[model samples]
Target: MNGEDAIRAVDSLFASVKNADIRQKLGKPHTNAGEILPAGVDSLINSIGDIDDQDIFLDVGCGLGNVLVQFALQTLVSKCYGIEVREEVLIHGLQLMDETPSLRDYCGKVAIVCAEASTIQLAFERPYLTSKRQGLSQ
Candidate 1:
């Protein structure tokens, strides 16, 4: 999809969640994962080792594309996909992507979808990044 379409897809997903209001009233941060990931999360993501261009990385419960964006920035993975159920979070990430001049270039490389974590598809049946794969750890 084009840049605007990518942006709108995220926006529409957020619109759906805002209309639902399930997580909004909980006082949780709308789109960021700062609450769940401890400090140095970005550093940890950057430190991941040995990912290649043919690998398709999936960010499960990817919130606002922070981790996914980081992944794309740090590595040369063939594709990076994120599945987040909340439209607000996905839209929020899209907004961030649109705002960041450098990240905006990655719109074509990264894909975000609004869907349940359990229902999301993965490129592999198992984790692509794990201790077993060394630098591929996620």
Candidate 2:
């Protein structure tokens, strides 16, 4: 499924969305998440402009998980994972993947974790980083 198939799929998924709220610590700035248009996602990935599928993608606050899904489905990355603290939002994303068999096909390659980012161990022992890929953030 190359071409603009992944983008079209994501656009379809978001078209059926509703409002959702996320909890934040008291007094802290209200954390707001924005939806990037499918074409914008394509442009962001295109800006990265990787020549090969060697990048490992990780979206810290992956609200609806469109970026990770698109990355994996579009063949832009070798592996993709999203860390979302909200269980309901994460469930909503998983349901999208379940409804679409093509997205489900990459279940092994895509992961969505419902947990606070603080709980995750970012300091990995493996050599996932390189001079070319200095950091993993999107």
Candidate 3:
């Protein structure tokens, strides 16, 4: 989608989500300061380092799921775990994925939760020492 189309899609998605607090947080215009990385938000995805083809990546405070989408498209993060506190933003991200075919495929490999970042835990399916050695080899 083009810029205008993307904007309209986001606007429409925002309209469908009903949480007041979430709406307030997302409805306002956003700045590209700390919300996005210095090298561009996609760079953050690249910084996650190597994992096996099946390892899951966790994105804390994933606002509109842009970083998650970028990683899903361009990297081998395998699965993405996005923690978003705002219900409206989460809904918008989900709806956007539902409406876009490529995004839908990306979403298939992702799990999103609406929750506080501090409370989210990262549990390893395998032991960290083994995973770290494997990640290094990759």
Candidate 4:
């Protein structure tokens, strides 16, 4: 699918889940549980330039995996990881991924982890970053 089509698909999937339900699930009086809209996703993809299949994308504080899903649909990034602290929201996001038929192919590439972003240590290394560091050392 193209960028616009991918954005529309993601937007529709996210729209299926109501904000009220998210707020209720969160049960926080003052929580900033907002997602990047389609426009923002478009702008983000543009700003990020080119994404290769070997590139890994990490979305810190990825709420509902919207951006991750979008990236999977819109880009060639092989692995997309979303770190979220709230288990409740993470559960919802996982359910969305599982239940959405369109996401079946991309789901394998996406992983939503329930953990504090700052404390989590990702095991995988980015090939581009590693090569860049090697070049610097040489």
The candidate maximizing lDDT is 4
Off by over 4 Å in 1: 1-24, 27-39, 121-138
**Which candidate would rank higher by TM-score, 1 or 4?**
4
Tens-digit lDDT track of model 3 for 78-121: 78888887777777777777777645765677678988777866
Q: Candidate 3 lDDT (Cα, whole model)?
A: 0.59
Query: Residue 63 deviation, candidate 4, in Å?
Result: 1.2
TM-score winner between candidates 3 and 4: 4
Looking at model 2, residue 137 earns an lDDT score of 46
How far is each candidate from the true structure, as Cα RMSD in Å?
Answer: 8.7, 4.5, 6.9, 3.2
Scored by lDDT, model 4 comes in at 0.80
Question: Per-residue alpha-carbon lDDT of model 4 for 9-32, expressed as tens digits?
Answer: 898877778876556444455454
Ordered list by TM-score, greatest first: 4, 2, 3, 1
Candidate 2, residue 42: lDDT: 79
What are the runs in model 2 whose C-alpha is more than 4 Å off? 1-3, 20-29, 125-138
Q: In terms of lDDT, which candidate is stronger, 2 or 3? A: 2
Worst 10 residues of 1 by lDDT: 32-41
**C-alpha local distance difference test of each model:** 0.59, 0.72, 0.59, 0.80
lDDT (tens digit, per residue) of candidate 1 on 85-123: 778757877776776564565555789989877674554
